[model samples]
Target: MKKLLTMFITFFKIGAFTFGGGYAMIPLIEAEVVDKQNWIDKEEFLDIIVISQSFPGALAVNSSVFIGYKIGGLIGAVLALMGVVLPSFFIILIVAHFFLQFRNNHIVDLLFKGISAAVPVLVLSGIDKLAKSLDKSVDNLIILIISIVAVTIFNIHPILIISFAAIYGILFLRKKVD
Candidate 1:
C-alpha cells in the first residue's frame, strides 16, 4: 500500500513539474525510477523508452504505465497512469479557462517563448543520455547512421525503422560459438 502511494506520488510530481511533454520528462523519470528509487535498472529503463516510443500515445504515459506494471502489477500501472495524467488534466482545464484571457499579454507571451526554447534542449539531453547507454559497437553505429538518414533524409516512419531493426537483429545479429 505504501509503495503504491509512493509510485502514485512520484508520477504525479513528474507529470506536474515537467513542461515540455514526454521527452522532457525522460530525465526526471530516469532520475527518480533508476537513480533514486531503484525501482528499475538503467537497461530496463532504456528498453522501456524504446518500447514506449514504438507504440501509440504519449511517451510519458506509456513509459509510466510500463514501469508501474513492472513494479506493482496492474494496480500499480493504473495508479501511475492516473498520477501522471491527472496533473496535466487539471492544468489543461485551468489553462483552457484562463489562457485566452492571458493569451495576448506580453508577459504570458514571453513565458511561453522561454518554455518553448527550453523544450528542444530537454529533448537533446534525453537523447544524449539514451545514446550514452547504448553499446558503442560498429554494427550499432552503422544502424544508427542508417536510421538517422532514413528518418531525416527519406522521411521514414520510426515504427517501420524499429520493426526492420528488430527483424535484422533477430535474423543476423546473434553471437555464435564453436
Candidate 2:
C-alpha cells in the first residue's frame, strides 16, 4: 500500500511537470525512478525505455505501466497510469476551455514558440543519455547509424525500423551458450 502510493505520487509529479511528451520525460523518469527512488537500476530503466519505444502507445505511459507492474502488479499499474494521466487530462481540459480565447494572443503565441524550441533540446538530452548507456561496440554503432539514416534520410517508418532491428538482433547478435 505504501509502495503503491509512493509510485503514484512520483509518477504524478513527473506527469504534472513534464511537457513536450515522453522523450522529454525521460530524464525526469530516470532521476526519480533510478536515482531518487531506487526502483530500478539505470540498465533496467534503459531496457524499459527501449521496450516502451518499441511498443505502440505513448512512451511515458508504457513505461509507467511497466514499472508499476514490476513494483506492484495490476493495481499498481492502474495507479501509476492514473497518476501520470490525470495531470495531463486536467490541464488539457482547462486549456481547451480557454484555447480559443488565447488563440490570437501574442504572448501565448510566443510562449508556444519557446516551448517548441525547447522540446527538441529535451529530446536530444534524452538521446544523449541513451547513447551514453549503450554498449560501445562497432555493431551497435552501425545499427545506430543505419537507424538514423533510415529514419531521417530515407523516411522509413519507425515501426518498420524497429521490426528490422529486432530481426537483425535475433539472427546476428544472438550468441549460443556452449
Instruction: Tell me the alpha-carbon RMSD of every candidate.
Output: 1.6, 1.3
The candidate 1 region of ten consecutive residues with least summed lDDT is 169-178
Tell me which residue pairs clash in candidate 1.
none
Q: List TM-score per model, in order.
A: 0.95, 0.95
Q: Per-residue lDDT for 1-178 in model 1, tens only? A: 9999999999999999998999999999999999999999999999999999988999999999999999899999999999999999999999999988999999999999999999999889999999999988888898999999999999999888999998777777876311
User: 17-100, model 2: which lDDT tens digit per residue?
Assistant: 888999999999999999999999999999999999999999999999999998899999999899899999999999999999
Q: Which stretches of candidate 1 lie over 4 Å from their true place?
A: 175-178
Error of 1 at 122 (Å): 0.8
Report backbone clashes per prediction.
0, 0
